[model samples]
Target: MIELKHVNKYYRNDEEELHVLKDINMSVEAGEMIAVMGPSGSGKSTLINTLGFIDTKFDGEYLFEGENLVTSSDDRLSKVRNQIVGFVFQNFSLIENNTVYENVELPLLYNGYGFHETKERVMDALVKVGIADKADKHPKQLSGGQQQRVAIARALINQPSFIIADEPTGALDTHTSTEIMELFRELNRKESATIFLVTHDPEVVPYCDRLISIRDGAIIEDRAVIHE
Candidate 1:
């Protein structure tokens, strides 16, 4: 459902140009779970932004369902980004003032769902992430794992075609990280949810179906992850 062909990104600084992504060629089918890993200054962030539809100024084509979405209008791209990608960040960007249900309900509201129509969808999302019982709780009252669960629930509430889990397990302890990864795997397997996981931890790679490594502003390796 997604393809990047000979894509390149450049940043201008004075009279010089900085190449961030060079000749990136990738295709992702629906229901695939992929992990991306890279060190600092490796251009992974640039690549992620490009794939997530936030960065459109590039040298090649970004095809979604066979159409070049990168060349679309800014307003169209913004709407498509909202409808096609859900983001889960490392910091668990939840509002401390909002209840779990409220946090999960925000996306539906943005998508034009009325308050009366959101309860079922919000509860289902919470249940999917195993946090339905904590719907009334606040972020400060929950553990880190639980907060992250809420974040994942919020991401899934929109039912976007792609979930961009940017270091989803980064803030948790080892045991909690394992639990969260297992949850993600279960969702991928049962729901056929397409996941694009960005993580630096090698331990997390085993849970993914494929891995792509980036270095020096280029894709150095892309291969399937064999689970044993």
Candidate 2:
């Protein structure tokens, strides 16, 4: 549901232009769990933002679910983003003051869901992420893994077609990371949530159906791998 062809992202700094991504070509289909692995400064996050419609000024074409992203308006892009792409970041970007249920309900609020519908969707998302019992808890009260699950619940509240995760397991220990990866796998396999994850952890690589390596702002390797 995502495609980038010859994509080039540039940043202008006084007298120099920094090229972050160069000639990036990628395609992600439905129900696929793809991991983007690379060293630091390999443009993994940049590519993820571009795919998620969070970044716009690039030199090539990006198509999402058959629509040309470059031609879409800002309003249209926002709509598409809200409806199609769910994002999970390395930091659990939840509001410290809000409860888990409230945090997960933010997206639905923006989508104009009624009170009853919002409660139902938010509760379902929390349950799906296995954190429904913590619905009343705040971010500071939860463990790293639980907080990440709340973030995942927020991401899933919209029932998005795809999820873009940037270092989903970065802030956790190995065991917690394993649990998070397993959750992602189940989401992909059972709920058909297409996931594009950016990670550097080799241990987490085996869980992905596709492994993509990036170096010097380009995709060095993109191949299907055996998943356990």
Error of 2 at 227 (Å): 3.6
Computed on alpha carbons, the lDDT of every model, listed in order, comes to 0.92, 0.90
Cα displacement (Å) at residue 68, model 1: 1.6
What local lDDT does model 1 show for residue 30? 97
How badly does each model clash, as a count of residue pairs? 0, 0
TM-score of structure candidate 2: 0.96
What is the alpha-carbon lDDT for the whole of candidate 1?
Answer: 0.92
* lDDT per residue as tens, model 1, 78-182: 888888899899999999999999999998888889999999999999999998999999999999999999999988888899899998998999999999999
Worst 10 residues of 2 by lDDT: 63-72
In candidate 2, what are the lDDT values of residues 27-77, reduced to their tens digit?
Answer: 888899998999999998888888888898899899877778657899888
Task: List pairs with backbone clashes in candidate 2.
Answer: none
Tell me each candidate's TM-score: 0.97, 0.96
Best by TM-score: 1
Model 1: clashing residue pairs?
Answer: none
